[model samples]
Target: MSTNSRWWFADLVLVVGLASFSGSIALTGLDGPLRVAFVLPLVLFLPGYAFISAIFPEAGNDDTRKFGSDKSEAIYAVGGPERVGLSVTVSVAIVPLVAAIANFTPWGIRVLPIVIGVLGFTVLSALGAFVRRWRVPANQRYSIGLPKLLFNSVGRHSNGSTTMVNIGIVISLLLVTSSVGFAVLSQPTGQQFTEFYVEGQNINSNTNTFYQSNLGDNGITVNVGNREGEQTQYTVIAVLERVENGSVTEQNRFDQQQVTVQSRQTKQVTLNGNPSLSGDNVRVRLLLYKGDPSGSPYRVIRLWLSS
Candidate 1:
């Protein structure tokens, strides 16, 4: 038991170390392939492995977990492939469950809380696994002997130059795999759309609060950015409205313009209005349409001209 055996020691240390390192990378907002590679295992494998290890700490037959049989007489353990499959399955279940639970909490399902939740669960499960393994007899407990066997095989052929070349090849393969995986995972797959906004007369002007008297002399500016994955033709219509008690009492069309913008480019349209609108919360509404302005507007932006 724990008095003499430490075979599970290294396994527990690796679990805790990986959890801490990945947690640090996430919390520090580090980005790129290295972070993705490290954190991927944390999310997809480690927690489930720790959970399974905690549940089954012995390296023996599957009869150990059978109901109603004598507990001490049998051991339930899994081989490497079975362990890996179980870990992935359990991790998939755990992550979403944790997220669902986090959805109700004050922190919601955000990065910080998820990292903390997963990290905490992993570390605690690892500790439980260690304790369970420690309580079992050394011969009956699960141990990672594959790495020792590999190390011994390498040591047998440790000629100076060949070993260095093997190590280099392995590192190179890992780096390449990590880079490709990150690229595939990080591709931009979001929806393509145009960005439309209203700005005051100048770059430094605030569009939210405008004086009605100065609007006729210095008109507002509308900017359109094409992120639609292609060149696009856009129609902009500007309207001045006077609203009293949440209802528009007077509405006047001010300006209309049509412009073509290339993908990843922006265009500005000037809207000048001479309508005699005098009141609090006078709105300058800009309607944006793609190609045809006959149907409903594709996007709408409003600016309040304060009295």
Candidate 2:
């Protein structure tokens, strides 16, 4: 085959591979299958374009050359065997890297930042590809090659080292400003509390633990209103630890912590309901107080209720 033909064939395979890889990442990262439906067409089209390009090689050389020659074009030059090896290497390496990072990270809510970072990187990579293409000169512009299209759709945007340094400085300034705001906000603010109500009338304490069990029992069941205006019985599986001076001393089991109710009703059974109730109609009031815990320096809360 001629160099032109060889180049075209290589371009075609590279585009298809990239599209496939990007589609895989998108499908994996995203929550739903809807993206796959949208991406399948593009995936199919990449190879299809290659086939058509082979048949009609002379039709659109300028556009093709422009779009196909971006950063992705360089990666495609590594022969077929090398290309496969690169793919395998990336796939194998990513898992352990993620695992190692996660292992070193702190537990509880603090780990959220790391998770957000990973997602941000993926998004930024996709965005960067598009930004690069957009910044390219019009005269030097290329056709919509498959790899460019996929990366443009999926990667993050970043200026090279210099731009990144500037961005870091800007981000540091913003963070400093935010820290000042947080410090101002955190100082000796009056206590704030959220109130949730539980419907007492429909609640059947006989079958539920609230009537039968003592403190630190297995579970408590309560009834709350459902979407249809009918009352539905729900079981509160855990109890909230009492808050003293704005902090919860103990953690409750998962089952008794929160009661799930239908969206239609505004009232939710609080874990801190009254422990003493003899009559059929008993009102349970739960109060949740928030405060900072000792040593950890993290703010926490405890719950208390009266029936």
Candidate 3:
């Protein structure tokens, strides 16, 4: 179709496609470099570019100023460099603004809400830009064949200095985007630790609801989540304590087990045996050790029962 129509239509289609793909990857729980690659553009470029397009639908003229009366009039279209620069800058601002607004809504700045808001804004902006661009005279409407333009610049020497400057800007923007993507995707070495806890039935079930008439009546499900970035060996020990007047009068070691857990995997150990407990406040404590149980416990969780 016409140049202006083609430009806006292509722009809108690209935005919609990218938004749909990125939203799918995020919502489907697909992660990795692919997700980041698709998502970074929406967050860093597309939204802002759409907005800038809406505001300045006419193509940039060589001269920014129009002289007629005593006062000089400003042109609506910005140059290539200005437009691209503004797109990146504005995109950065828009993402956070969308998130901030979503924070107050029922969705509360979650992934789904933020994605919907950004996509909606971008789609609307693209439509506005399309309409505005079409309204301009066919001759004066700003339009460019981006692939042809870039190809011509690189394939042959068309515009010498200007072409080089534009290329430089493109390269700089790519570098900035790549640097950000690398920083986000790179896995840095952080503090390594294991998550140890005691629950009732399931992995995260409330332990407070678990009470036993006798110490041996209930089984304790101990979960050891390995976050050491590698497979780890752990020792879990269950201790039965008889407490009276805020002091433990007697303590007995009931069960001990060794478990091996992979990085980011949780292993559950069930302690089902304990001696007969007799006291006002009886406590069943599960002490976790990294490797050996000879030293003090690394993590401790207790279940208290009133008899």
The better-scoring model by TM-score among 2 and 3 is 3
TM-score, cand. 3 vs. native: 0.63
lDDT of 3 by residue, 179-289 (tens): 989876675767578898765442223435235653467567778998775678999998888888989898988899999987667889988775667555777778999
Task: Look at candidate 1 and give me any clashing residue pairs.
Answer: none
lDDT of 1 by residue, 1-307 (tens): 1223465567777878987888787665344566677777777678898998898787653344544445433336554445555776787678788888889999998777888888889999999999998888776677666533122221123466744654554455456546656664565757578999865543334545666666787777788998775678999998889888999989989888899987667899887767567677688888999997988999998777765
CA lDDT for candidate 2: 0.36
lDDT of each: 0.72, 0.36, 0.72
Instruction: List residue ranges in candidate 2 displaced over 4 A.
Output: 1-96, 107-115, 130-234, 237-258, 261-307
Candidate 2 matches the true fold with a TM-score of 0.26
TM-score of each: 0.51, 0.26, 0.63
lDDT of 3 at 275: 60
> Sorted by TM-score, highest first, which candidate order results?
3, 1, 2
What TM-score number comes out for model 1? Answer: 0.51
Candidate 3: deviation at residue 297, Å? 8.8
